[model samples]
Target: MPILQWLTRDEDTRAVRSVPYRLLQEESALSCGDPDAANMLIHGDNLDALKALLPFYAGRVKCIYIDPPYNTRSAFEHYDDNLEHSKWLAMMWPRLELLRDLLAEDGSIWVSIDDNEVHYLKVIMDEVFGRKNFTSTIVWQKRIGPDSRAILGAAHDYIVVYSKNLEAFKATANKIPLREDQIAEFQNPDNDPRGPWTSSSNFSAQGFRKNQMYKIVTPGGAEYYPPEGRCWVTIESEYFRLLKEGRMWFGRDGRGMPRKKTYLKEREGQATWSWWSNSEVGHTQESKKEIIALFGASNTFDTPKPERLIQRILHIATNPGELVLDSFLGSGTTAAVAHKMGRHYIGIEMGDHAVTHCAPRLQKVIEGEQGGISKSVNWQGGGGFRFYRLGPPVFDEDGHVREDIRFPTLAAHVWFSETNAPWKGKGKSPFLGHHDGKGYALLYNGILGDRRPDGGNVLTRSTLQIIREAAAKKAPTFDGPLTIYGEQSRLGPTTLARENITFKQTPYDVRARR
Candidate 1:
């Protein structure tokens, strides 16, 4: 496979490892509506914020949508859209890696870009999320009208999509609801009792199969056979079965070519396609108008996506109560749409607009403001989101755990580092959890009521016995190798081996740094 290279390619690709995981410090004052809602809006650089989220949200997000700076070499009021070619690539590589880590195995990501860097973006995404995972590049008509002044009027943008696993995504992906025009295609010409039905004209397929070239006699006693280069869609027996069930259709004169009558009641919906017209989803002009209505004309966001566009994505990519994430949250269109659509979301933005624009807009959404897709989804609103800022790193410059780090925070990191999975255990016990035939335990910050070097924080015979009891109480069925994190182990190497225990020192084997 080919790779995109630049001056800082090596360093940029490895940049995610160097990013110290920081804490998400929630601002209770900035939160609104239901305090316990799972929605979150974070104010921080996306790279660091994504790293911070791994311990809690990795492999959990069902859908991710990001609209990064297009690097169009033009100035914008909100985003720094201008950047050197290599710099743009460098900026994106590590973030893509982090986003890949955050995605569930059956999940997918949608990225919005333009001609400025879309080709390069596709190459890197193929590298990060495997090429086989590449789904489609949807041509979204972002502009309703053409830019008449340009040599070639640009009216579209590309939405590059990729799934974590193609087969898994296909198994669970939703279909797009049929539009009015599409539904109009199904009509009851004969007033069949089944419902509105549509006819499939191509009864003969492009293949030469002797078994499928049988003759078919219409109700008018006119016979038909497969064309020169084709065969009937089904064998004679299946065709006779369908004809007996009244599933065959002919023209009003009863002497036209035979067709299949498919009833509307049997159709789930329409499958998604590559081209998305402005009339189907929405256009940029509609997006700007939405932002203007929410924030007013004077303070409208520069490049907000229309709520209906995000709504379309969420509808196909996720179900209700699934997790959605957007690191380049921009004007919070993804969050608002996900909220109204009943999917939990985490929106990260580095700019102050996170507090100013994103939060306020979501507040309106929670308040039942009937803007954007609120009426379309029948959003009466009542949910809420917590606001957070990037806090101190989990580890300081010296690679030591921060003083403010508590048991729950360190435990989450320890579990994630050990198993590469989210921590679902409560911090009340030293036993973290078990994964893949290994039991993990963490003794930190007085979780066992004693923090002394020789007490609960150390792996002594007594502490080992306590941990064993807790593990047995939790799992009960079987025994496994135990990997425990503590300050020190008083047991000898022979005893440790006999007990099937591997003890790692705290703050050293914690994996807070690369």
Candidate 2:
């Protein structure tokens, strides 16, 4: 496999490791509607924000769509759309790595780009996400008309898609819904009792098979044989079975070649193709108009994606109530679409427009403002989202856990460090959760209802009993090797070994894992 190399390739590849995990500090005042909604809108650099989310959302997102700066070598009001080629690659490398870690095994990611750096982006994406997982590139016609000033009008942008695991993604992949024109193709020509249907001319396949070369006599008593270098789609016995079931068509006159009748009621959906026209999804001008409506034309977002484009992505890549993520949230089109379509989402944006553009747009969405795809999806919205900003890092300069870290925050980190998976702990007990046959407990910040020296932070005989009692309440039958993190342990090494217990001192063991 070929790898894309740049001046800072080595450092860029290792950048994710150097990114410190920060805390997501929620702004309650900025939040809207339901306070407990899983939807989040964060204001921070996406690299730090993604790293911060790993402890709680690793391998949980069903779909991720990112529209980063295109590096188009042109000035934009919102983003620095120009960058040195290698610097742009350097910036994207670590972010992609973190996004890959955040994606579920059966999940997929879609990235929007243009001719500026799409080929380079593809090469790096092929490296980060395995080349084998590369799905088709969708050529979205972003422009409805030709560019009068350019020699060759660039009318399309590429959406590069990749799945975490190709086979797993395919098992849950959805099909595109049939358009009105496609549905119009089906008609009840003969008034069949079953339903409206269209005839398929592929009754004969392009292959020579001995069993599939039998004759077929239509209802009109006209016999037909397989054409030259072709064979019937099925053997004689199967053909007769279908004919008895009225699944074959012989044209209105009943003397034409045999065809297969596919009923409209039986069709699931249309298979998605690589090309997408502006009529199917929307054009850049349409997207610009949507932004203008949301935030007045004076404060329009420069590179906002059409809500229908994101709608089409969510329709194919996810089901209702599934989780979606967009690190480069831009004008929050992905979040708005995901919300209207009933999917949980986390959108992260770096600029102040996260407060101005994205949040305001979503607020209108909650109010059921019928713009963009709102009318199409019947979006009478009644959900909410929390607003957050990147806070202090979990660890300090000397590599010790921050004193201000709360139990829930440290618990998430502890669980993730112990299991290499996202933490699902509810922060109600000292026992975080069980994973891979090992039970984990954290005795920090008075989790055991006592903050004395030997009360909760230290693992004494009494505190150990309380921990066991809490663990039993959660998982009564979970009697396995116990890994507990506390300040100190009173039990001797021999006693700890005999009890199948591993005691790790906090701030030391946790930092070591990092």
TM-score of each: 0.96, 0.98
Worst 10 residues of 1 by lDDT: 505-514
Cα lDDT for residue 174, model 2? 92
Cα lDDT of candidate 1 equals 0.90
Off by over 4 Å in 2: 512-514
Q: What lDDT score is found at residue 456 in candidate 2?
A: 80
Q: Write the per-residue lDDT of candidate 2 for residues 234-261, one digit (tens) a residue.
A: 9989999888898889988888899999
Clashes of each: 0, 0
How high is the CA lDDT of each candidate model? 0.90, 0.90
